[model samples]
Target: MQVFNVDKEKTLNAALLILNKLGQADYHKIFKILYFAEQQHLKNYGQPLTGDVYQAMPYGPVPSFLYDVFKASENQASPFSEALELSKAFTVSRKDKIPYVSPTREADIDQLAETNIEAIMASIEENYALTFKEITDKSHDSAWAKAEQATETEMSYLDIAESAEASPEILKYISLQAENHNLRIS
Candidate 1:
């Protein structure tokens, strides 16, 4: 199984970039849009931009570490919330009994490449207006199904690349990169 090590800082900043554009958005929208963005990045660049480890969740493929940070931030009453460094940059609050995430500060755009920003912005435009079911359905691809059906829920980068329709050559490159990374992605 090819797993990319989570880049916590880049992950937070990437999520922040989405939230910064959305002003405040439901986690469903945030995660779904980012899932597509991940596919786009994988297809275009053959490397991860946010570098989050994806997990097959009920809603879709959720970035494991990013979701943990969001959960911690949203549940401030929990002791874990205070321990999360990302809470300093992002805030999750409820309105109408629905959780919404907002950035405490602007996204550090420097962490993202021009192509990364372009992909994310395009994904946002494409997915932001979609309903919960619509977006959730969109994320239910072969990659997610492989993780969802397995004992371990972690998504494979190879599966993700395949689901993104990456060419054989790009897939080979990604496989080699993941192998060389040895699960320690930068």
Candidate 2:
């Protein structure tokens, strides 16, 4: 759940790719996985899923940012439409910014998004390992209270760690909480 402030276009492209891949009717599965990851993260962190599940969840295919961008377009086209516009609106360089390599068809885009999702998940998993180490180190007092206090003092680390383990659907929530924690600390 590395919540970077990505560009709107990039986010939108990713969403469109996912929706197109999952297909309009069966897109819920992608959403469900991401959402579930976020829920699992919240449960682990003892936090509620109030906002921004993308940052909280694990896995890939979280579509909140993409959905926002898709909805914002003047034309409320479905993922298919948006993706079509995106294929034309953006250049190859910009498409690289998105997870999907090509925007030709639903299956092609879907496969690309799925691959990107796996990469994202792998990235989060690796980062989680590192963050977990940091948290464990900072809280290495051999006492539960000390660990809790340490994490509380620098909650972003803990929050991100929690989110890194989250399901994809709930990842946005995890990201939101982590961002809030970072803001407070900053």
User: Ten residues in a row with the worst lDDT in model 1?
Assistant: 76-85
Q: What would the C-alpha RMSD of candidate 1 be, to one decimal place?
A: 2.7
Residue 182's lDDT in candidate 1: 79
Compared with the true structure, what per-residue lDDT tens digits does model 2 show for residues 79-166?
5554445444222212323322223343233323343455434333433233423433433321223324452322232344343454
Q: Pick the candidate with the highest lDDT.
A: 1
Off by over 4 Å in 2: 1-3, 26-30, 33-64, 73-117, 120-160, 163-186
Error of 1 at 92 (Å): 1.4
Where model 1 places Cα greater than 4 Å from the true spot, the runs are: 77-83, 184-186
Candidate 1 lDDT over 1-186, as tens digits, reads 446766777788789999989999988899888888988888878887677888898889988778878887876533554327677677888889888888899989888889888989999999999998999999999999988998988887778878999999888888789667676221
Error of 2 at 99 (Å): 24
Against the reference, the lDDT scores of all candidates come to: 0.82, 0.37
Least accurate stretch of 10 residues (summed lDDT) in model 2? 50-59
